[model samples]
Target: MTKSLVGYGPIRQTRVGVSSSRGFDSESLGYHVGQTLGYGGERVYGRLDVDYDNKGGKFDSKGNRISPDVNQTDQQDTESLSVNGSLGVELTDSQRLDLAVTYYKDEQNTDYGPDYGDGLAVLFGAKPSLKAIDGANVENEPYTEKSSVNLSYSDDDFVGSGSSLNLTGYYRDEKGRFYPSGKTAGTQASEVWQANGLTDTATLKKLASAATFVTQSEADIEVMGLRAAMQTETEVAGKKTLLSYGADFERENSEQTYYGQDLNTFLASNGLTAQTNGLTYNGGPDTTIDKWGAFVNADMDITDKWHTSAGVRYQKLKSETDTFTPIYEQLLEEYFNSPAISGISAAYGIDYQAGDVEKGSTDHDKTLFNLGTSYQITPNDQVFANFSQGFTTADIQRALRDVRAGFVVNSDNVQPITTNNYEFGWQGKHGDTAARLSGFYNESDKVVRFTDDYTVEVVDTDERIYGVEGSLSHDISDKWQVGGSVAYTRGQYDKDGDWLELDAVRLTPLKGTAFAQYQFDEGSNIRLQALAIGGDDKAFKDQQKDPDASALPVTGYMTLDVLGQVKMPVGRVDYGVYNLLNKDYLTVYHQTTYGDLNRLPASGTTYGLSYTVDY
Candidate 1:
């Protein structure tokens, strides 16, 4: 919401608001302002915004809390700032140049209490006993800064009559730091005690008094790109047609640095030579990616009621990764030479041989195509069908790290994934009513799957997924309106044997939302909404073939919410109550790398109020 300053014409607009919700110790504040200046054939605009958030922790079903428990600070707090500016110049009648720039910074400090492990034990039936400790304090502080600038030039008749050309160039940089406290130290203690089969209370207490494990890390990313596009109107067999094409190239650089401890070597240096050995993580790595893409499409009227379009895109990607050898490898070699540890490793089929950092490069090239047709039954209604192919590389971050026991690369060969998608839909509007229905079928090859294991491994496989979605809305009168929407999805893995329901891939098969609203004569309105999420338990139980391997099912839940606004002379009052009924449900449920179940519970009831003025 915004309000204009008096006597400033269209040059000044300002906005401000305050919001409060349950579980937070303090309210949030936001402010924004924009200004514009215009002269002969030129205009410039700029905007500045700031947001401050004070996050209050949440409560579980038992009324226990898991918020920051630090001694002196707001456990979960965030501050963000954004600035944007644009300049436009009318070089000539049909030619123009525009330049824009944006900068954003987000900084957050978060703390966690001890009760964090309660839900994990109860819901997942497994505990990170080594990592979760009583009286242990956990904190995460991350700061991100980003900025971008773009320049564009356009000409209406550069390529002849009824033709236009546009070109753009841009560059962006993002830098951040990821620092965690207390977590690594706690886990190290747990692993050491377990590996040594130690249960003596006095010994355990003495070990706990040792130094905590901590790491310092930093990340930097940079991107630069350029694009050019042209559009023209022409006649194809006497039918007017539009042809559009574009080409783009981008380069990105990513780097990460980490500093940590080596448990075995550190303890041995302190006269504790008999202590069990455990590896640690430490290093700095970098990856560079270059991508090039080009696409062309044609839109033409086949008949009075029918239209068709065809397009194809050619994409090429090249990536190179470089890693530094960490301290863990050296420690592993030492352990291998010791007779005591060597026997244990040999019995377990363990290989302590470490390889040098796998510095290498990979490339991917693909040509994707799209075809579609639409038929207009009336001026306000239409039905369309589309088929398309797409290609995407695996997660870059995942490619850089191995969660395997030795933190080794899981595989030496990596490949891109491809998807084939088919879709059809119908959309129509009649009077005060509107509706839509759509269905889609998609198959993907070489999809990445992370197995539920302590040391995670990335696997590739084929899969098919299909879904349908629909929505309808109608206005009963000038003062009342109602609308609702629903979606359903199903998926299967293309295994060597019989196809199985994609167990590793968690998807809620059915979900829906409905709402009703009342509008007053003076631009004021209130809305009530209901949302339903279907349980995955029933579907899993029926589809799972192996009883021993099946996981706990996800339960279904429904919630209610309300939103309203009141119009005043110079401003509007806005408010909302989320989860009005305080429904208890899990928003997400899945297995973690350690084979432990993980769940994120939905928030309890929360309310917020804010005001905006247009002065």
Candidate 2:
């Protein structure tokens, strides 16, 4: 068995009217164990793990608003325990088979001030209004139970030529539960507010008090998948060649049960009726999805100094709903006036049907391809280039719902977002030094993005991102090594077009990292590293309103980290500190919600220690 202890702390200082603080006293404990057993040509491996952690610190809230306490505490505690075992068998000298099964249960609880919920509410408008709710004590409890089985087989005697066949399969079941505190419930109200535009904040406040406060609910999901592949090696045109083919299938089913005073009961107690205020009660629905695909690839060497590879894949996806819960329609008629609700209705194109509604299942199919080549430029240098195409299917989230509801139109039957990528790169080595450089360009069609109201939509316009990245490393002596990497990227929408979310924030245009490490004898080592990120200032709707805001000027920042280690008879101990310079900056923005980049304050310095051993 192995055991460990961990701790972290943060200190913050605001230079420009932003919230900041300083403190520590956070920690965690973890333990794990593993063993092996053997019988003839078969081997079995088993392992167990347990862990607990708690974090406490303070920082600014939304929009750079400083908190009142210099030492506010936000704590998260988690406990996870799992056990797994696997068996491997040697069917022959050149063939093998393996099978594994695992069962895991994890429970986590988080308690923090209103900052957590408030931040989410402000950005997505997805929560109940805090103005009408009490937040002195707020907590979120989420837990998951999961079990899985895995199997694999491999064989290598196909017709005497070097060839192999492999097969793998997996099945998993997951059950989860979530509890919403008063603060979380309030966030739900915010979501409704943005969806319906019923700006009666006071009415929402009152509804907040009477709403069905779900202290807890249960969500369950099950998934199964299988993959099989074959590969062969042969001589072609006096050069070695490899060919591979594969197929895969996957399926998932999910159900969510809401437990609490049903919506009708709560509304009746509050002297409300479906007709009295246009209120309606709808529950959660059950969902199911099925996906399957097949693919093939080939690699051939035309000459000793040149090689090429190619691949293609085809996939199909289908989704359907077993039931419909009209929570949205109920809330709209009850609280929002008919006109306001109608506008939203027209925007999303939702049509209400009285009887059991079966949303027609959606079907999608796609194909992807790739090609690549490599050449040796010199004895110590090589160059390569590749072009590839890829796609990802959409999910049943708010975006998809809006697409189905007719609030938005994608015109492509919600086809998968597709990307074509091209890259050329080189690598070389010179004695004790090594270097690599690459440039890449990616073009995406049917780009999907979220709208200001949290609805999903696909833009007809295209998007392009191109960049260059390079890295180098050198060994100055037997005891010391140094390395660095730099990258520059440019991303933009096509000319004369704009994407609500992408247009409002800046992606990291330039980023670089440098590091140095020294080995002081065999027992000790030390290392230091630094990172810099830069981006052009971004402009948002709110910032655009301010003539003096300078269109959200581009921001730049840097951070540093240091680490040390000492070897012991049983294990090695490691210590490290991160964000040594504590630079404050915002790393991302969700323009659809908050209308500005959520500023991520510089994390204060944190130090921790860990130990590892090999039997």
Best by TM-score: 1
**Candidate 2 ranges with C-alpha deviation above 4 Å:** 1-22, 26-75, 82-84, 100-106, 115-140, 144-147, 158-162, 173-221, 254-287, 333-358, 402-412, 494-509, 538-554, 582-602
Q: Rate the local accuracy (lDDT) of all candidates.
A: 0.61, 0.55
Segments of candidate 1 deviating more than 4 angstroms: 1-11, 23-42, 50-54, 59-64, 67-75, 114-140, 176-218, 261-285, 324-354, 403-412, 454-458, 503-508, 538-552, 589-600
Q: How do the residues 1-615 of candidate 1 rate in per-residue lDDT, one tens digit apiece?
A: 111221223333344544434544332222333333322222332333333334444453333343332211222345666666666666676777777788887665433322224322321233433221223222335567899999999898884575999999999999875533222222334344446565677755544434233343557889999999999888888888899999999998887654443434323232111122233343434777788999998899999999999999999988776654533343344444446445644654555554456566778889999999999999999999999998777756444454222333322465677899999999999999999999999998764554423222234668788999999999999999999999988877654554667542455558899999999999999999999977765435644563323434556678999999999887788888888887767553422112332343445776767666653
For 1-615, candidate 2 gives per-residue lDDT tens digits of 101101111211111111112234332222233333323322322233323223223332221222111011112234555656555666675666677777776665433223323223432345422221222222224566889988888778755556788889999999975433211233444455556564677766654443323223466788999999999887767677788998999888776653433333323322111111122233334656778889988899887778899899897777665545433433333323344344544554433333333444667778989999999878899999999987665555333333222232232454566789999999999999999999999888764555443345555568777889999999999899999999987665542444322333334547899999999887789899988877554434434532322224455667788888888777677777666655455443411123322332434555556665544
- TM-scores, all models, native as reference: 0.77, 0.71
Clashing pairs in 1: 3-614, 3-615, 4-615, 24-56, 453-593
Question: lDDT (0-100) at residue 39 of candidate 2?
Answer: 31
Per-candidate total of colliding backbone pairs: 5, 16
